[model samples]
Target: METILEVLKKMEKATAREMAARMKIDAPDALAMLRDHEDRGEVNQVNGYWQLTGRASKKPANAVPKKTKPPASKINEAVLVKLLHEHGAMTSEQLAKLADTTVRTVASTLAMPVNKGRIVREKRGNVFHFNVVSKTALGASKLPESASKPAIPVTETPKTASIPEKTETPAPQSSTAFVDTIPQLVSTNGQPAALTPKIIAGEIRKTKSRLVQLEKLRVTVRTQTRLQRSLGL
Candidate 1:
């Protein structure tokens, strides 16, 4: 009987007489039912003890199975942009090394829409380098030409040079005074004058000496003013 079989399963291994005693059934009937189960391979007999077979002991076929979850992506746009900003421009291999992932992963993440304007790629030498696009550069690239530089309208005509009124020219000064005013001996267009380091140094020294003289003159003038004020002159 099913009651006798349930008792046998709970006991793990039991003699047919023991199962009958637990189920309160006749020993003969319990032995006959156990013998039928053994023939059907649902139970097995080792020596005089009977036990449920492996197939009969398994969980029911209708039980729910655990579902397998999908793996998550390891890299994203923010992570790649952060790395580019911290390290400046870098190749795919360099980024991969710093991110602790594969080059393909870095490439795929950078190709997404979220990173479109934030990251830019340039080819230098034989390798492609990745850079984080600065806010200023991105905005400049998006600006219209007229917005960046004011455009002159074609309808507006530029003013022409005006004729000067007749006037008397000023008298010429001495060539010596004009020559002294020249800051340095610079090479003019198509002139053979050579501008050497020695010449530059000499000009610098002359200018410094002139500045010191001017400073001394300023101090002397201040002292003279103070003295005159104190003497009521």
Candidate 2:
């Protein structure tokens, strides 16, 4: 916390991103520390930048006191959710960098979201790459592979008034194997719920399109850390 306050004193305003970079910690960690200070009347986020308050204030600067780092226990779901939204997919090891926590911590924390369907974990090679749950998948999930024609949604204008208006569900595929793109889902009754139409036809589809640049970020951070060590920061 003292380290954070000192950094804040040097800068006019600092966003979570800037603070994280300067502190050589994860962005979520910096944000969490700032918020903790804010709750204690020591700091506040102003114009998207964290600013010091009270004893931690800029005027009549206080000495940067030595303090032990706090144990990381709290899991910031909002930060995790935001990261998944931006990157589309990431492993817990990669995600730990953004959260400024250990990979083990993230692995434990991700269980709830994965179980709840808020995050989908797909096994790529060995480690699971966590992706955001597609909120718009509802429309596409109802159709099976055997469906001959894509049903025109009720929202669209019909070509002719004489034509009968009806919504047709696709026949369920016999294969139970999960697809590479979207995994097949089953309901509580152990019945396969088709997903083809639910994923594609839905007006509100939210799937991860791009992979998170975790490796690049890790490389850059390592370089920065080495530089900081050399400078005795």
Candidate 3:
């Protein structure tokens, strides 16, 4: 409280923000302090500014007044966007009047959204027209001209061929035209003209035994001749 009072005593007039800045306090705290002082008759409001009471005023208590800054106005961007979007477009001069803010503040606020692609602007001489970009038209604008036409899709039905009736196959041909062997696979006469493998094997064993007997006989004749010559017979 003393910090605010001392600041107020120095300046002819001060806003909440200015008082807060000098006193190292929040604006709301400064405002509350000022209101408390005003209630206690320590300070008074002069055109929305905080000033010391006439008794503490450095100027003559009846010295009328001098020009001072008006209360600071805040820019309402949401209202700005709505107003521009609904009203088609408007200049900063016109927007400031509608938003009850400074033209400079409105101009700067509108420019920020434009650089972000959220708004659009058009210029004419010294003034520029601003409007918030609407999302409803975005999709339609991005589509190609050819896409706008309704597509007529053609669906082709698959061709189904007629199924052939089932038919009986002829009996297999025994023509024997492709036969390679006759003696081994077919009968030449009604009699069994084939030789059994067992009979052939038996004949081969007999021939081998007869050859072994002849070899023994030859060995015995050589032994007898050698013995008779030794006995001189």
Output the number of the lDDT-best candidate. 1
lDDT of 3 by residue, 125-145 (tens): 888788877787667777898
Candidate 2, which ten residues in sequence have the lowest lDDT sum? 203-212
lDDT of 1: 0.69
lDDT (C-alpha, whole model) for all candidates: 0.69, 0.66, 0.68
Instruction: State the lDDT of candidate 2 residue by residue for 1-233, as single tens digits.
Output: 23677888888577978977876666765665666555446677766777776433354447575454465655666788888899879998789888887665576456546656777889999878998877677445666755847777789654323334487997666456443224335655566665676665441333322223665676788779766766799
RMSD of each: 30.0, 37.9, 28.8
Q: Against the correct fold, how does model 2 do in TM-score?
A: 0.31
Off by over 4 Å in 1: 1-73, 113-115, 153-233
* Preferred candidate (lDDT higher): 2 or 3: 3
TM-score of each: 0.34, 0.31, 0.33
Worst 10 residues of 3 by lDDT: 177-186
List runs of model 3 lying over 4 Å from the truth: 1-72, 122-127, 138-170, 175-233
**Distance (Å) between predicted and true CA of 63, model 2?**
35
